[model samples]
Structures are given as structure tokens and as C-alpha cells.
Target chain A: MCGIAGLFLKNRALEPELGAMTAAMLSVLTSRGPDSAGFAVYGQAMPGFLKISLRGAENFDFGAMAAALDVDVSVHDDHAVIAVPLEREARVRALLVQRFPEVAVVASGARMELFKGVGQPDEVSKRFGLVGMTGSHAIGHTRMATESAVTIAGAHPFSTGADQCLVHNGSLSNHNDIRRKLIKEGMRFETQNDTEVAAGFLSWQLREGAKLDEALGAALDTLDGFYTFVVGTETGFGVLRDPVACKPAVMAETDDYVAFGSEYRAMADLPGIADAHLFEPEPARVYFWERAA
Target chain B: MRVAAAPVAVNEPVVFDLAAAGLRALNAALAGLTATTNQTVWRVKNPRGEHAIAVGVTAPVCIFVDGPVGYYCAGMNDGADITIMGNAGPGVAENMMSGFVRVTGDASQAAGASAHGGLLVIEGNASARCGISMKGVDIVVKGFVGHMSAFMAQSGNLVVLGDAGEALGDSLYEARIFVRGRVASLGADCEERPMTDEAAAILAGLLRRADARAEVGDFKVYGSARKLYNFHVDHAGHY
Candidate 1:
């Protein structure tokens, strides 16, 4: 099980202050996924994107890949930031596919970003500026490798396409079955993480014109075993608790904000939280929180 | 309304008279003290392993039991903090509302049973039936808990940093049970669920709050299978 957190601020600007809030919230949950920590910050100007961690190949050239795609790429100690042209994202994606196919595209967006690595929360925060950036909505993961190898790529908030990412906490018994189906549909995989298969499954449904909630519901139906996943997109976020509701998930929402975590303490540090009521998502229920159009 | 009274200052040596006091009296004396002012620290020099030493106090008082305590030492407690320096008997801090209850030594059955709120931090092992029927409470056990923990739990959080016994969370409701170590067996109507974003967030938050080092990915999720929610002939095996 890994710790996942996301905050969607309605009528609130995700600036430095909000970034600090996210950092504080994630800091309290450091023990959940001490292996790695990653987050995505959404903003107005940036095309939302997911940022993922990459290790083992220290000599990998991110600048060349960015230049090839005509986008700016910044490399940190354990992560890299890619800025994509929203209108020409498909073209850039083709370039990414052509080059550096080994490097997994974790998540993306003008505002959507994802970063993950192997270490404690403090280490990941220092490497990724997890506590420094700000956005109206953000999602994070702290992973403890279960079924997959404990590599940086296996960390969560995995993305299949631009502005589409997912973080999960339980295993899918039918991962291979789902993966086989997804692979047939042209979904490529970078790691052997079962969560990646789930990401592809959700994306495939969404690509078929299903709403985010409907797609997640279908994924839940198709997937077997204990799982609770949260999918984030450019416009909104969706949360699903499996039929058994085995994993722990608490949601506290108001008119202006919706905060969800495995425990209430993660939200204890959020600003403007006077009194927070906690409720678990009903079994097999798909809950969606969208930024008003 | 019998009340047991004991008065002692911080770092003061005191002897409790449990022979003359019942559970309600012990709680009254504890509740009457001012915890925030730090005027409520009492040391039990000769604890006779009595039951319900300090249950249901809203103050931030700290009571240190020098020796072992009997059942329900801090049941349904609110704010008063109690730490048993030695081992404890059954049902310590059952249905705790708030504050911190720590047991330095091992606890018998039903520690923090049905706790509605508060943080119950047990440094040592807790025996069977921990957090059973809990509602909205958070329990962090550094060691193992016995069988049927969180049984029929409606709401709250149970974090077992160590291993868990058989049939955990049998017929559970909405409570979230996170075990860092092994689970001997899952209870009836309990099935593993896919970990969602909300669950990941909640688990991560709990680890941080409990200061536990267990990773979210290393744990497994377990809850009711929903087949017995209303009970049907097709799912009669669960009964």
C-alpha cells in the first residue's frame, strides 16, 4: 500500500502558499510511502503534465529529448520537467515515442504534473520541490513497492496520456489479463508495475468517449482484487473504492475544496480548515470532483 | 455516582486507593484536574491492577501507572492522557474520543475497543479484539494485536505497525485498518479492495501521523465484501 493525496481548491489560486500547503500535507504522511514522493501542480499557463522520477541511467539525455519535441525540459537530481505545447501535444508525443521509448511518460498537463522517486518524503521534496510549487489542484504518492521492483519508475501517479494520471494503493489480481487487452489496443508499458496496467485500462475507456467516472467504474468492474485508485485529469479528479472497500480512504469536502487521503492527519495542515468531517467512499462507488466548467 | 479521588502534582509520588473507588470515581478525579495547566500529573506507586483507572476524562492530564492495570483502564476517554508504565489488562482505552493513551507494556484483549475518537498509541503488543466496534477513532499499535480486531468497526482508523491475528475486521463497516506486518487471516465478508487515490492519501496521512515507517505500497487493503450488507440466501456461507 502507498499513500496518495490530492487537493482541489475551488475559487482558490494555487500559488506558492498552496504549494507550501501541499508540502505540509505531504510531509505529515511521509511514513506511508517512505520509498518515494511525487506530486503534480496544475496552473493556468502551463499545459498540465505529470512528472515522474527516473534513475539507473544517469547519463540519459533529457535535453536532447526536449529539443527533439521542441519543448523545454529541466532535469533535477532524480526527476525531469517537460513542458509540452498543448495544441501540438500529439506531434510532440510522436517525437517522444520515436525517441527515448524506454523513458516512461509518468503524467502531463498545462497544469498537471507528476514526480516520484525512491526515498523518504523529505528527500523527494528536496529533489522535486514538492513543497515549493503551487496549483489549484495537486496529487501525490509515496510508494512502498509490493509486487513490482522498487525502482523510481514504479512509483505512482502513473500516466498513460497527456493530462491523464492515476495513483493506486491495492493490487489487481487480473493485471496480466488487463495488460494483454490494453497492449492489443496499442498501449505501451515502461515498467511491470500493476498500477501502470490500471492506468492504461482507464485511459482506454476514456479514449472511447466514456466520462472519467464511467471509465473508472468500468475499470473497477474489469479489474479484480483489492484496490482504491484516484485518477486526475486536466479538468477534474475521480476516486474509486473497490467493492470490498478494503483499503482506507477518507474524504473531506466543502464547496470550495475537496481533500482526500488515507487518513485525516494529512489534511490537518491544509489552510482554511476549521472543522473537517470524514467519510469513507462506499464500496464500488465512483466519486468524481470536477473543476466547474 | 461513585467517584474515586486521587490528587498528586507533577513528578509527585502518590498511592492510589482503588479498593475504595470504582471506575466512575477514578474518572471523576482524573476529569476534575486541569490538564492544560500541567497540574494533573500523578504517579501510581502501588497500582493493584485495578479496572478502569482513568476512563473518560476530557482534560489533558497525564496518569502514569507504576505497575500493571486491570481492564478498561482508559475506556471511552476524551482528552486525559494515560500511560501505563507496566503491562495492562483487557480493554484499555475502549471507545476513546481524544487525547493520547500509551501502554508501555503488553496489553490483554480488547485494547482501545470501539473507540469513537482520539489517538491510542500502544508501544507494546496488544492482545485480541483491539479496536473492535470502533467508530471514528485512530489507533496506532507498535506491536501485534490479537484476533477479531476492528470487528464490526463502523468508522475510524486502525494502524497496526506490527502483525495482526486471524479474522481481522470481520463484518467491518467503514473503518480503515492498515497493518504494516502480516495478517494471519481475513474475516468473514472481508475481501481485499483495489487501493484508490483516496485510500493512498489516507494511508500516507496515517503513517505520518503515527510516525510509522511502513510504506503505503507494502500494505494490503481489506474490507467487507458487501455480499452480506443485506444478507441473501446466495451469500449464506458468510453467516
Candidate 2:
């Protein structure tokens, strides 16, 4: 009983408003998952630069760390979204691992930064300025804690590989067995959320040379559970549901952008929404749109 | 002399934009319609997959919803002719007492579930457990019906122009099921009954009401074997 919402900015003019729009969509789904919230915002990827988002304890000296590392870090509540040169990314990450062991690197992608917290969706979005961030495409989740405990680590938009993330709406019934297989395959797990296992599965599939559509369709055979998966990749996002389609998922596409929600009301208020071509996704079908590289 | 006043005859539709008025107000207005005087036409816009649209309208009215609807849309409807132009979520028109509800697209689980009276027409497929525990509703599905349809149906007519899913009419009672296509599997105590001229006439009437045309000979009837109602010690294992 979680909610998945995403927005892709087909129109570059709306890039600045991606965070705000995605936040509003996630907030509308607060009733579905009131325990915790998270988002993966995509910003422009500068050549030879890496963006690493880290979560630290309250009152952590993010400014001091930025000065020491000679990198730019913008503090948002307990998070510091740092943008550094590609060469120094390894050095800075190693430094954080050795000195600031408490800081958890949520995710580091070329154009995406992930933020998550344990609280009501609206409050968490405001705390992290999630509504103010900008990007080309983004995905967010409001979790109701069916698969694991309600903790920041268990929140969604779980990324197993760089620039690859996923948010799930239904429980993966066979996660425990699959988790062991993934663990044997040398994937690191930070939490017990079933959605994380799904993320790892996709990462493994994509790493093995499966395209987005093939990865999602193969999921129907390997993953045994009721689920509606909304996946975010570097180029674009895709949506898929179990054959039963027990989970709710709707998609709307206008001239400017493509939007996804658990219900249509989540997208009812979007700009140019009235003229959008809206429909419920078919069961067991992979509905995906990607921008050509 | 108590002659009931005629229902408000507004030539143009009274549009209820759910985006502006909210679902609560929309349902409240539909329920508050005068029982004696039935409104003529009502249009609901921006339903946007909201639940329970136009539920419990006892008045004789015609409702036109422009978008997809969530669970239990038009549930417990009575006398209102409701037409949904898009797909319906689970339990659409469940437990309807009387009236006509037409879903132009597919319907989710338990369509017309436990309905006592009314004619339900589905232009597309109906998902699992359709017409489960139905009482007296006359349901017509133009496409396939998923597994466990007509389970424990007490009394009703289910007319399927397409295939019926596995375990069709399982544990069925007096209710009759007319299947035009193949039955993947049959439930316990449900067996094929011979199609007669009388049953054919009834099916033809139902098809006509659903705005469908099919020869009565195309269907085969399935009903209870009448053995499960009485416990036989030797048949206990099957039961």
C-alpha cells in the first residue's frame, strides 16, 4: 500500500520546476503512504563532474566539509548535495568513508540526486526543499511500511546502480529467497525493504545487457508478487505491473511531458492535463518511453 | 389525491465537476434526488478515477461519466441509467438493486457482485470473480471473464459472448450461466445444462437489452448439479 509518482520534463522550460511539480504529485499521494517519503531528482550532468548526495546527523558541519574538500555542498536540513569533479569523487567518497563514517551516501548519479526522510510526505518534502529542486526527470515514493520497518533507510526510490532507481507499489512475496540469490551475486543491501530487492534485480538485469523493456518483462517471470513498478533510468522512466495487476497505476502523456501516478487525481492538476492522452496501463505489459541518446 | 410531482426536467445536463465539487458533494447530490421525481440527465466530469461515482441513485435518471472510475462506482444503484465511458476499477456496480449500468470499457474484479436486480453491459472484458455471489442482476459481458466468475451465484443471468475463465460457475446455486465461448474449467457442483428454446429466448432478450446481437444457439447453459446442497457421506471427500 505505497504510492509511486514520477514526472519527466520533455519540455526543457519545465526543468526548473521538476522538483516542485514532482513534490506536489507525491504530496497528493500522502494518504497512500504516510510513514515516510523519498525522491530522486535529476539535474543536468556536467561533463567530468559527479553529484553525490549524502545524509548526515543534525547540525553536521556540511559547510566546513565543503571548504575542506574544496567542493560545493548545499545543505538541505540533514542532507548535503555535493557536486564535485569526476576525478575527486572517489577521493571525497573515500574521505567521507574514513572521517565521516556516519554519513550515508544515498546515491550518486551523473544527473540525479536522491533525498529521503522518515516523516509525513509534505513535511519531508519541505524539509529537504524537494519542491525546489530541478531536473529533467524524477521519481518519488510515499511508503506505508508493509515490507519493512518505517526508517529512512527503508524509504524508496532505491538505487542499486548509478543513475538507475525504482519505486514499487506492491509487496514482493518472494523477496527473501531472491534477496539471498542477489546477495550471493555480490549486491550490497542496506535495508530489508522488498522494493530494494526489486531495484537490485533490475540493476543485475541491466548489467547483464537487458534493455529496459526486456528487464521489466523478465520481471514478470522472475518476481513473484503483486507489483506496479515505476523505474527511472538516465534517459527516461518506465512502468510495469504484475499480470494480475492488483496494484493501481495510471499514466498520462501530454505534448510537454509524461506523468505517472497510482490514481488519476494525482495528475488531474498538471499543466495541459486536460488535453493529455490518459489511460490505465495494461497488465503484464511494459509501457516505456525513452529519449534517444 | 397524492400525485407525485414530475422530476426536474432540465433540458441541458446538470454537470458535476468532481475536480471542483469533490466526490462527497457529488454523491450527496445524487442520493438526495427526489425518489418520486426522477431527474432526466446528469453529467459527471473530471471523475479522474475517483471511487464510488454516482452511487446509490434510486431515482430514474441518466448519468454520463466522462472518465475512468475507481472501486464501487455506481454501487447499489437503483433505477438510474448510469453509463461510464471509460474503464472501471474493482467492484463497479457491485450490489446494485435495480437500474442499468453500462461500462464502455473493461471492468475489474467482481463486476455486478451480489447485485439483486438490473442490467449490466460490459463492452469489454471483466476481470476475476465477476458476478460473484450475485442475486438477481442480469449481467452481459461482450468479452472474456476471468477466473471464478459466477461463484456461489444465488440467482441471476450471466451472459458472456466471449470465453469464460477457469472455474466458471463454481459452487453455483439456482443461478444460470450462459457461455458462448469455451469454459476453461468448471467448479464443483456445476455442470453443463442442455440449452432449451425457453432458455434461448431469455438469453436473446438479455442480449438485446445489452445492445448485442448473438444467436441463442451460440450459448450453452451451466447450473448447479443439485448434489452439494445435500451432504452424502460417500461424497464427503469431494465436498
What candidate 1 gets wrong by more than 4 Å, as runs, is: A45-56, A59-69, A86-91, A94-104, B1-239
User: What's the TM for model 2?
Assistant: 0.86
Estimate, for each residue in A1-293, the C-alpha lDDT of model 1 and write its tens digit.
Answer: 67778787776654556567667767766766778777766655442533333331565787776677677776765457776555676776676667677665666655566677777877777777666676778777777778787777787778887568888888888899889889999888877888899989888988889999899889777998888787788778889977655565656676667887765556655654434443446557799988752
- Clash count, candidate 1: 57
lDDT of 1: 0.73
Model 2 segments beyond 4 Å from truth? Answer: A9-17, A254-256, A271-277, B1-13, B38-40, B124-128, B143-154, B160-195, B213-239
Encode model 2's per-residue lDDT on B1-239: one tens digit a residue. Answer: 11113334564577778888788888888887786544568888889778889998989988999978888999999999999988887899999999999999888778999999999999998987889999999999999898789999999899999999888998999899999999989998899999877788889899888989888888899999987888799976864
DockQ of each: 0.04, 0.37
Name the 10 consecutive residues with the lowest summed lDDT in model 1 chain A.
A47-56
Q: In candidate 2, list every pair of residues with a backbone clash.
A: none
- Docking class for model 1 is incorrect
